[model samples]
Target chain A: MIRIDAADDPRVAAFTRIRERDLTSRDGCFIAEGEVVLTGLLQRSSFLIQAVLLAERHEQRLGAAVQAATAAPVYLAGQQTLDGIAGFPLHRGVLALCRKPEPVSAADLLGTAPADAVVACAFGLSNHDNIGGLFRNAAAFGAHAVLLDGRCGDPFYRKAIRVSAGAALTTPHAVVEDELDLIAGLKSAGFRLLALSPAGRSSLRQVRPAGRVALLLGAEGPGLSDAVMSRAETVRIEMAPGVDSLNVATAAAVALHHLSGRVEA
Target chain B: MIRIDAADDPRVAAFTRIRERDLTSRDGCFIAEGEVVLTGLLQRSSFLIQAVLLAERHEQRLGAAVQAATAAPVYLAGQQTLDGIAGFPLHRGVLALCRKPEPVSAADLLGTAPADAVVACAFGLSNHDNIGGLFRNAAAFGAHAVLLDGRCGDPFYRKAIRVSAGAALTTPHAVVEDELDLIAGLKSAGFRLLALSPAGRSSLRQVRPAGRVALLLGAEGPGLSDAVMSRAETVRIEMAPGVDSLNVATAAAVALHHLSGRVEA
Candidate 1:
């Protein structure tokens, strides 16, 4: 591990002002914060680890994980210097920069999915926390892949990655530019699409998943468009009177739990 | 409505430096921000409304709701003055101070629950977002009430109330000081205690809600304690291998969806 004595060290410059960088593009790279996410970068993700930055105190505990990333150089700095480089408090004490995987098409992802797979599709979901929660739920419920329309927030956003508990790194996903194209791709793939909405004709319990299924979720206030709902089997969760709907991510978990096929057995 | 041009107007003292006040005690009061929560405070909550503060622009949009809270006086200020008083930009342009509801015992809440009821119980959940998510899920699934152990975060905190989508204002909840007593109360009240844990012996699909059911959820990392699991029917959602568990609130949503009796029909 190389010691970084100065926050402005040329080798560690990429790690500086992280909060500001999160708002802009990272070229082809993304930041993974906290020990859990760092571990995911080194161990689970297929992405290339560009480098690993660690606070001096965390080196002892995180050394093994860093060592496993033989191709990436490890940079160590004191807590003060690390905080200066991050432009914020370094509570997690570990960060890693990784190359984003090459982009894939929605058709390619659905074409390669398992015969009886479950997938999550998001539309107009702009919240990073919701994006992260969707990935976490997809991972837990064994969804084959996640498909997001262009309007959804980046799953690799630093906060989204942390909120996802690093599932963003391991989960296979693709961002489709057009909603209509994504819908057509799912239909051609012979996947049953279930769009969640408060105005659905059938309740969640009434629908039976016969084969491969895809659950479509939209933003909280403005639900799935009529065009999207018209093509798919629209379903709604039975909620208490006067309540509009569940949080987008919470609704995804409940729907995925029922459609996962794990419940059938 | 009273016009207040100064940020330091004594009539709006309780609304000043809200972010700072959030860290300290309100002496049996809580702040509800955003128009949605403010409407909930005025129309839904049983708690008394102490006052309402609004930016001049919001008066036209929120006038009807504020008028309904006849007992509480409304104070209007310019956006600049409102921001100065809040110590931050007030994007939602609305805020309210509400008296906390009188503390109810776990026994009292359980005793009053409907014969066919679903209740969510939380243990050691210290995160405000998780606490809020739990209430939102409980409300979405038609759970009759929510019970949090003393270790959980206050649901009435500003962020919690907002994240709960104002469900915290409408949901009946009680914070029990002791987990054991809460468990005993559920049992004596003839409620089934289903402790959600990763190591649970039965999958969530195996359980059927007969009468009154209470779903017990713990924090994310350190889940329900062994002692608590021993007395309850430990249940788990079947997940993909290598995943620890879903977020606490997501888990509650899935479990409550199953046990809520809404699905049984």
Candidate 2:
């Protein structure tokens, strides 16, 4: 590990103006914070490691991870310097800058799954927190992969990564151009498409899966588009009157747990 | 409706310094923001209304409700004046100050629930977001009431109310002194207490809940305390390998949906 004294050093330049950089910045790399997320980034062979910047105190705990990132530059700084460089308090004191992997196609992600696999798919899900929670639920329920429509937020966003508890790094995911293409791809892959909505014809408790299943979800307010819902068998979670519906991510978790439990059984 | 020009007027003093005054200075009243939450606060007969402060634009849409709150004072102000009074931009352009209802004992809450009812109980759930999500799930799954131990955050907090989609206002809830007393009260009421944990003895799918069931949930990381788990029959949600457990609120949703379905059946 190389010790750095100045926050403005050229080697640590990528870590500056984090919040501002989050929106209008792209250098083919994303920042993963916290030890668990860093560990996730390290485990994945698909993404190339660019560098790791951590506080001096975190060296002993993250020694093994730093050793593994030998090819990438490792910079060590005091908490103040690290915070200054990050444009925010570095409470976790660990960050990894990693190169993005080559984009995978929708066909490629769905084709590799088992015959009875369960996959989580999203449409127009722009909220990072919802996306992150969706990924975490997807991982917990053993979904084969997460399929995202183009309108969905980037799963690799820092908040999404932190909220997913690093599941965004580990889970196999891909973004496709059109929601229709995703539906057609899932259908052709011999999977049953179940669209989740408040007005679905059948209750989730009564669903009897055939073989493979793809759970389709939408954003909080508008829900799934008619074109997409028309392509899939609609299912609803029974809810009390007056309240509109469950939060999108919470709904996704319940649906995933149910479908995955059925598939595993 | 009364129109006021000054931001520091005593009539609108309860709305000032909202973020800072949230913790230390509550005088048996809380601020309810947004149109939906205001609607919820207006609908509840138990909570006494102090006054309603709304932007002039919303005066027409909320005219009927404002008229219904005849006993309480109604104040109108311009968007700038509302923003200045709130110490933040009042985009939703609505706020309500209501008196907290008299504390209800845990026994009273459980006693009022139906014989075959399902209740969501919490211990040490301090996060407002989780608390809000739990209430939403409880409402959606037809839970009779949400029982919170002393350690849980105030469900009536503004962020919690908004996050719950106003479920916090509509659902029957009570904060008790002791977690154990809450559990004991449920048992004596002929309700089966089911503690949710990752290391539970039986998978949730295998359990056929009897008459009344109270689903006990804790915070995300620490989970249910040993004292609570030992006293109740522990049940687990079967998840994929490697991942630890689902978020506490998400777990509550799945369990509540499962038990509510069984109870209804």
Candidate 3:
């Protein structure tokens, strides 16, 4: 373990102004915050860790993870220096700079999945919280993968990773260039594409999946585009009259839960 | 419409330091933000509105609700004045202070529900986001009322109200002193009490509700107290192993969707 005494120390350049980096770019590396996320990052073999920065107080609490961090240099800093390095309060007190996995094509993600896998595909999911929640739900329901169209936010973004409770790190996901093309790829792979919307001929409770299924979700407002809805079977959650549709994440939770049940049946 | 020119106008006292007032005290009045929430508040017969403050620009857009506000006075102010009054930049540019509805006892809330009603009972739910999501789910699924123990946060709080998409205004809810006693009342009201827990014995997909049903949810961590869960029939959502349980609000959504389907059947 090495001690980081100064905030401007080049060793901690990646951790400076975390929020600005979050909005602009992480380059090829993603920042994982909090003990839970850092622990997950250390355990995963898919991502390579460049370094780990932790508040001095959390050193003992995260001893196991630090000991097993292999060759990654562990830097411990005082609370003030840590906050300066992060450009924020740094409440969670731990951060990890990780090398993002190599880019994998949407087709490759689908090609590698098992026959009865359940995957969540998002179209224009710009909200980070919604993206994180969807990944958390997908992981909770044992989904094989998550696919996002170009417009969706990065799940590896700081807030998205935190909101996902580290599930984004464990879940296999890829971003495709075109949404309609991704839908077509799923259809070609023998996966049933189920488009979830407020307007649909089928109720969610009544629909049953037979084999590999891909749940297609859209943004909260201006729901699934007509072109996308027309290409797949549409299913709606039967909500009380006059009520707006469920939040995208909550709806995905219900759909993932329902689809996961089919695999067991 | 009454024109309010000054930021310090006494009539707009409710609009001052809204974020601070939101935390310290709203007294018997709650601040509703945005056009959607204000619309719900204006239409509700149970609560009386004291005043409506709108940016000069929104007058044309909200013409009907503003014109038909009856006895309630509508105040118009410049965007800058509204922001100064709110102690923050008001993006929605609309605010309403409505008198909180008369408190109803847990017994009274359950008594008024129909024999087949679905009520969401929350125990120790202090987080506003979770409380808001639960209300939204309850409203979406046509639940009759929501009951909360004293440990829960006020649903009428500004952030909760907004997060609920104004469902907190439309849905009937009551808070009780004793959680255990509330559970007992639910039993006597001919309602099948289902305690939702991660370690529950029965899977949610297999559970069937016959008559009046109460879905009991607890706070995110340190789940429902043993004293409460021991009394109600325990039910769980089948999830992928190693993944943490669904967020409390998401769990409630899945549960409400399942129980509401029984009412239709």
Candidate 4:
């Protein structure tokens, strides 16, 4: 472990001005914050851990995780220095810089799936929290993979990773070029496409999961485009009257739980 | 309608420095932002609407909602003035100050629920977003009411109400003194109590909804206290081996959806 006293230390340049880097380009590197996410980076993520920065106070509690990351250089700093490096009051006090994995094709993600696989697909999901929540739900429900359209936010983004409880690092995912490409690819892969929308023709309870199922989720407001919904079997959660819909991520959890196929006891 | 050109205008003081106000005291009045929440305030809430503030541009779009709030005066200002008053960019261009309704007891909320009702109860939920999401799920799944322990965050906070999609205003809710009181009340009301926890003895699918059901939820990490879970029948969502649990709000959504008692097609 190396000690980083100065916030401007060259060895820790990748961790500097984190809030700014979150918005701008990061040169193919992404930041994962908090101990849970850092553990995910060390253990679950397929990507290389570029480095790990932690507050000195957390070293005792997180020493095991740092030791487990044999390949990554561990940098420890005081809370003030760590906050300075992050450009914010990072109460969690653990952060990691990891390399982004090489891009995988959507076909490859679905081609190797098990016959009874469940995969989650998102289109135009701009909110990172929603993206993270989707991944968390997907992981909890034992989804084989996640596929996102080009318009969806990056699940590897800092907040997204934190909100996902590190599921973004562990879950296998591919970003398709667009909704049309995703639909065509899923159909070609022999996956039953189920789109979630308020105007869905089928209630969620009606859709019997058969073979491979690809559940499609859209953004909260505009939802799945008409063109996309027309191609997939649209399903809606029966809701109380006067209410329009559930949050995209919450809805995903409900649908994923049901589709997980746990027979009622 | 009132026209306010100055940011410091006393008539609109309640709407000034909203981000700060969110953290500090509000003198019994809460701020609701965005056009959607404003509509909830004007139409669904039992609380009295004290005033409404809008960017002049939204006047054309939200004029009907403003007009419907017969007892509240509407304040119109330019975008710059509105932003300055808010101490941030108020992109939604709509805000309202509404009086908080008088507090209701857990007994009263439970007493009013129908014999076959499904009510959601939250314990030690300190996060406003989770509280808001719970309310939204309760409303979406046709829950009759929501019961929150004293430790839960105020659902009327600006962000909570927004995150709830304005369900915080429309949904009937009560803050009980503590978890013990809430448990006793639900049992006395002849409601089947189900507590959601990772260590639950019963799987979610096993519990058949019989009559009035009260689903208990706790915070994400610690979850419901052991004492609270002991009194209620513990149920767990079947999950993948490695995952610990779903987000609190997402779990509530799944449980509420199942307990809503929809028949499969």
B68-160: candidate 4 lDDT, tens digit per residue: 656678899999999999999988999988898888777888888887899999999999989989988999988989998889999989989
**Candidate 2 CAPRI classification by DockQ:** high
Estimate, for each residue in A36-77, the C-alpha lDDT of model 2 and write its tens digit.
Answer: 888766766524668889999988768557676557888899
User: Stretches of candidate 4 above 4 Å error?
Assistant: A262-265, B262-265
From the highest DockQ down, the ranking of the candidates is: 4, 1, 3, 2
Point out the worst 10-residue segment of candidate 3 chain A by lDDT: A39-48
Clashing pairs for model 4 are none
TM-score of chain A of each: 0.97, 0.95, 0.96, 0.96
Clashing residue pairs in candidate 1, if any? none
lDDT (tens digit, per residue) of candidate 4 on A45-117:
6346888898888777575566765567889999999998889997989988889888788889899998989
RMSD of each: 1.4, 1.9, 1.7, 1.6
True lDDT of residue A100, candidate 2:
76
- The DockQ value obtained for model 4 is 0.94
**Least well predicted 10-residue stretch by lDDT in candidate 1 chain B:** B39-48
Model 4 chain B: lowest-lDDT 10 consecutive positions: B39-48
In Å, residue B207's CA in model 3 sits off its true spot by 0.5
Candidate 1 per-residue lDDT, tens place, A27-123, comes to 9999999988887776766347888899888777686567765568889999999999999999888988889988887888898988889999999
